[model samples]
Target: MTTHVQLHDRLDYQSVMPLMEELKAITDDDLVIDAGNLRHLGTLPLQVILAAVKQRAARGQTTRLANASDGCVDMLSLFGFTPETLTQPEVWT
Candidate 1:
């Protein structure tokens, strides 16, 4: 089964811990991150997302970002991440 984690409007420092815990709980399933509502994407949260993607890849699982908001897309692009790059586990490195 796939586990979905919806990103909130503000993905800042305060939300990172809980989000990490949520990601940890879904280690056994394919993970889908709903990014359509994201307004602010902090560095820490971005790190967490990258870590989750890398971990999933190591476990032979998948992690995907769906419906990315413009803010999310722009922020990712600042780090040189395209939608296609985001799906590749290697990009997290």
Candidate 2:
């Protein structure tokens, strides 16, 4: 099964709890995170994403961060992360 979640426009401290809940609720084999609306990516949510990725990795599930906007990509790059790096479990460490 694949669970797809559309990310909010701002992934900051204010969005962490709900975002975490959304990610945590996924019980599928594939997790598809649609980040096309992102305008800002904060450190806290970045951790949340990494944790989710690791969790999926440990469970042998797969995750994909897709359709990110240019600003979203820039934000990830600011933190030294590319879209590919976000999904690869090994890069989290």
Candidate 3:
């Protein structure tokens, strides 16, 4: 089954740790991260997502970022990421 993790409106330092912990706890199944409601995108949260995507790849599990907000898209672009690239990890690697 696919696991869905919904991102909060504000992904700042205070809340990013718990978010990272949640991502780290997923050991099996595919993951779909919902960024539709994301208002603020922070570097820490982006790192957490990248790590989760990498871990899932190592385990042969899929990780997709869905419904990304404009803010999320803009922030990701700063790091050379596009919305489509989030679902297709091989594109950047």
Number of the top lDDT candidate: 2
After superposition on all C-alphas, the RMSD of every candidate to the true structure, in Å, is: 1.3, 0.8, 1.5
Model 1 per-residue lDDT tens digits across residues 9-45: 8988998999898888885568788999998889898
lDDT per residue for candidate 3 within 1-93, as digits (tens), equals 888899998898888789989998887678889999888878887777887787788789998889999988887788889877866667866
Candidates in order, TM-scores: namely 0.91, 0.95, 0.87
How does residue 92 of candidate 3 score in lDDT? 66
TM match of model 1 to true structure = 0.91
Which stretch of 10 consecutive residues in model 1 shows the poorest summed lDDT? 83-92
Candidate number with the higher lDDT (1 or 2): 2
- The candidates, ranked best first by TM-score, are 2, 1, 3
Alpha-carbon lDDT, every model: 0.84, 0.91, 0.83
Runs in model 3 with CA error above 4 Å?
none
**How far is 43's C-alpha from truth in model 1 (Å)?**
0.3
For model 3, give the RMSD to the true fold.
1.5
Candidate 2 per-residue C-alpha lDDT over 1-93 given as tens digits, one digit per residue, 9 for 90 to 100: 888899989888998999898899898999999999989899999999999999998999999999989998999999898998998979767
